[model samples]
Target: MQETLRRMQKKRAAGEGGFTLVELLVVVVIIGVLVAIAVPMYLNYRKGAANKSAESDVRAAVSAVEQFYTENGNKYPDDVVTPGAVGVKVTFKLGAATDGQQVATLSPGNTLVYKQLTTGTYRICGMNEDGKVVYKYESAVGGSVKKTSDANLGDCIGAAAPA
Candidate 1:
């Protein structure tokens, strides 16, 4: 029994008592499976976060426009000025900018497109950094921010909200 114990201790000292190949492979496979499940979930969460950020930007633009309207005789600004004190980057699509227009600052990659639909109505569309998610706020419909189907800003007009 003494000899057997000594032999066992010698084997452990030689690193012969470590995990077998099969045990190590099983652990690696389990880790791979966990990663496979976690990666897609993490990506989806990131996408949702980006969309929410764009929506927040659109809401900020709406607030700035509303403020301008309230302070300036209930008239909306002809075009949003860039690098304003509040909100994200804005691109006016209606026409040339007029003097004394309210400014809306822009972030590096995100963009907000503003258009005066009519004299008393306006629309603002915001795009995420990657330009994949778009959110729009239209005063004519319900003054609620909603996701838009259109991706590009060529027209700067977003589709109507789903019923």
Candidate 2:
């Protein structure tokens, strides 16, 4: 028969035919355990999408500082931001929002920016590093954002004092 079909195609290419180093080390240990459970769940879903894009830029900077404090009556905007003003450069420029040991700030010469132990008055906030769902301006507050070690919330809202 053509030499017994060429010895059955060389005994089906010597029997096993391919993969075997214990099946390529069990597919490289199942792709290294699915990349170690998908890289810390893609780095906590990229830090919860940069903390919901920094709480939607803290409710668009508390509605642009309450519309610049109701069009410049109650004060607040010490000027500086004007450049294109939306979320004011990714949620108030950050470096942990300029710490005095930072958590948020700006004010001096930039006019009114606060955060670190803020007393800018109670208005916008966002909590959820585990203190559990807080938000303020875009609404959803009920108290409980106290996990403070400063993961950069700019101290979270006008903290109930600064008028």
Per-candidate count of clashing residue pairs (backbone under 3 Å): 3, 6
lDDT string for model 2 (20-115, tens) is: 699899999999999999999998896666455445544555555555545545544331221123333323432222321112332111112334
The best candidate by lDDT is: 1
Question: Residue by residue across 42-144, what tens digits does model 1's lDDT show?
Answer: 9999778767866776777787787777767777776432222233444433222452355444443566767778779888877766767667788989657
Task: Report the Cα lDDT for candidate 1.
Answer: 0.67
Give per-residue lDDT, candidate 2, residue 126.
Answer: 47
**Alpha-carbon deviation at 109 in model 2, angstroms:** 34
In model 2, which runs have C-alpha deviations exceeding 4 angstroms?
1-9, 13-18, 28-30, 48-52, 71-123, 132-163
Prediction 2 global C-alpha lDDT: 0.43
lDDT accuracy of residue 152 in candidate 2: 29
